[model samples]
Structures are given as C-alpha cells and as structure tokens.
Target: MLIFVLQTLAEILAGGTSLTSTKQIDFGHPIDRREEATEPILNVYVYDLRESKQLQHSGRQFERNKTGSMQTANVSWPPTWIDVSLLLTAWDKTTLGEHHLLAEALTILLRHRSLREEFLVPELRGHGNLSMTVAIEPAIEISSLWSALTIPLRAALFLTVTVPFEAQTVPKSLVWDRIVSIRNKCLPGSDVMTITKRVAIAGIVKNAVTNLPLTDTTISVVGTEITALSSEEGLFFIEDLHFGNYVVRIDCPNYLPQTVNFLVESQTYVIKEVLLTPV
Candidate 1:
C-alpha cells in the first residue's frame, strides 16, 4: 500500500515537472543520501502512520455472494481509515533548483484534493478515492524534525493522506444445499402450514427524578425467563417474542422496581421507556 501511494505521487510529479524520468523521484528517510550526482531528485519520506478516529465504525462482519455462484463469501468488518504523513523534499545542488522542483510538486498535489481512482493501482482502485491535504509546517517543528533525523533543515511540504485498509474475505457456505434439504423434509400431516409470528421489544431505562439514563437495570418479562440488562446507555432489547400481552418488570439497586403492561404484535417493534423511582 505504501509503495502504491508513493508511486502514484511520483507519477503525478514526474508528468508535471520537466524531469521526465520517474527515477528522479524517491521515497525514503530524509537522512538518506541523495543521488544528486546523476540528476535532481524529489524525495517523499513517510514519517508517521496513525488510525483516524473520526472515521471509525462498528466492527460488524457481513457476507455477499461471489460473482456467478450460489456460494457466499464473508467480508470482514469495514476497513479502518489510516492517516499517512509524508515530508516532500526537493534535492538539488542549487537552492533555486530545489525551490523550483518543490513548487512544481506542490502545484501538482494542490490540483487534486483527492486522488482519482484512475490513477490508483489495481489493488487500491476498488477502495475508492483517497483524500490528500498539503500544509506548511511551522519552522520550529520542521527544524526539530530534521534534527531528529540528524539531517540539515531544508524546505519541505507536509502532506497527509487518508486511505482505507482493505477488508479480509473468506469463503462461506453455499445457499442452494440448505434450501434443497429443507424442501425435501416431509411431515406426516396436512398440507396446511402455520407460521409463527414474533415481536421485538426495545426501550431505554431512565431515572424518574433526574431523567438520566439508568444503567445496569435488569428488565424481564413476567411469567417468562426472558430477561435483558440495560447497557451503559440504559438501552435494552428483547426479540423473537410471541404475539401477546406481556408484563415487563424493571429492577435496579437503590431504585424502586416498576412493572408495566404492553401488547406485542407480529412484524412490529414495541418501544417502551421505563423510569425507575429512586429510594
């Protein structure tokens, strides 16, 4: 993945600048030796990698059918967004040449806020476009960075690229076999079939006085063993219940227990909010 990004950037700069050969572009540590004896080179050094917290999502796995087959494939949880920081430095014997190359590279990068899919390699093309931001780093910070690298301070552009990691894929079971086996099963009875209807009950528990969420509250259906504990957000859910009238009881420490009656219907979700009175 790192190679692909560097290559793409090299391609863009190589095409835009007077330097026709991509060999003039390099990706390595800033302290590395520059091949200035041959030609002026543009070095792209990746210094940091971190996950983007804002783009994080629920880690839920899903399955999709492969092309032209009844078999399904499991796709691992969504890819995580990662931020890659690069220091772009132009290496030339003359200071004027260095500034000119840096300006050209900056111009090309600024033209595209996000890289186009057509420019990406085959592996990254399916992931969609990646976002890139070019910014100027403070002189003090830049000097500190060069000091840490044990190299002389030079003019450089700070580039941050946001890209997604690919999700893992695995083969899942075939659907046709399960369907055929179910159809083959025969019950020695009339042809009339009865379908069972289910209902979903979901709600949140809160404090009666403060109206704040009450976590760790236990909720149960009367005359049944079905029960669920309220989450940190004071939310609880119970599903696959038969259509009927049910009494829901809520219990929590230092709080008065409460009971309420609700009706459940087929193919419907009943939402209830329980407010527990504090002792």
Candidate 2:
C-alpha cells in the first residue's frame, strides 16, 4: 500500500497523464453444478487534464458472466469494493503539487529495459493491488503500506483519492522584503557621476528543513519611502528609480538580515537572486 501510494504521488508530481484503477479476481465464482461458470475481468482507467473533471481513458473493459442455475451458481463471492483514498491522503503534495503522481510512477515501474513487453506483465491482484514480474531496475525507494479493513468493500468503492495542495503548505501572506538600486554609468576622459536608482528586492523566507516557500518577509530601501513585498513566487519587483549605488535589505522575524549592493543602469532592469539563510 505504501509503495502504491508513493508510486501514485510520484507519478502525479512528474506530470504523467494517464491513471488506472484496476482489480483482479483470484478466485472467480466456482463452476456451477448445472452450468459452466465464467470468470470476471475488470480494469478502469482515468485520464487527467490541466482543467478539472478529466476524461477516462478508453479501450479498457470489464466483463462478468453467470454460468449456472441460481442454486448451483453459489460460489465464493469476490470483494467488490475497494477504497484507495486513505493512502492518497497521506501523500506529500508540496513536492508533487500540480503533477500527475500516479501515471509517472506507473511509467517508471513499467519500464523494464532488459525484459520484453510480452514477458513483463502487470496484473492487478484480487485486492485492488498491482503486481508485475519483469527484468527491470528496482525503484530507489519502496514503502510498504499497512492495509486497513475499515469499511466494507462496496461502501469503500465510492471514496475518491485527492491530494489537495492547500492542505500541505501554509498560506502565503504579502510582505515587503528588500531594496535595490540601479545606476547608469556615463564615463569619459572627464568626470564620473554616481546616481541612486531604486529597484525591486523581494523574496520569500523558506524553511531549510521542509523547504517550504515562506511569504511576508519585510523588504525596504534604507532611508527611502520605497518598499515592496514578496509574492507567492518569493519574488518582489520594484519599478521607477534613478540609477546609482543602493543597498537592498531583507528583514524577517525569524531569519537573519539579508542585504545586497547593486547598481542599475539606464532603462535596463536588474535582477537579484536571494536565498534567505535559515537562522
């Protein structure tokens, strides 16, 4: 279960497009006393898109047939419901947000370079789990998920797996963080002039441990009324300033003071990349 959860998350985060929900029957209905019994086969596949409400992938089918009289047809009943939502809920969305985690993971697992496609077969087990035997490279990591027998199979079938990004990361707030100065150089055999220009300086405070991007770092140009705040991208841009030497500073409650000296020239824009060191 853990491997499957991680596999799905990894696939989604890697931008995979296809998703599959599969099931297998280990023991089909027994041969009826009065008639020949038939086995059942089922596989459901769904495709994801950039927009919500994606379509299901076509060409997959499920089939089941009854063979004997009602009395003779009595056989072991296969589990009909399987809920995959709980495992999906535990995924780390911050790393794979906006990516199709299931599909990519399947692709990685399906790729067995040494084995031919005919030899490498993947079949879902009776418990809604996938199993494959092929000559391939094993994944770098594999987690064994503990199985739970909470809900009955039929009731569990309705639960959907959703990894919401909002729940994984803290919401970012607006903040002003840094000050930058752009300067123009007009030099000749005569005199050199230094002018002060203001540029944008802003970046989010990210946790070194979790690497989650932070927002609301205070940014300002010293001795000036100009100020700006970092956006969700941890970027802050300042506009309209004379070119010259300027000190760009970033101040946040938990992080250390981060500053840079930059000179902007002419109509060109200057960009500074700041990584806030964790205190």
Residues 215-248, candidate 2, lDDT per residue (tens digit)? 6766787767877776554556655544456687
Candidates' RMSD to native? 15.0, 25.0
User: All models: lDDT?
Assistant: 0.73, 0.35
lDDT of 1: 0.73
Candidate 1 runs further than 4 Å off: 32-36, 63-75, 138-141, 170-279
* Candidate 1 weakest lDDT stretch, 10 residues: 176-185
lDDT score, residue 183, model 2?
A: 27
Give the best candidate by TM-score. 1
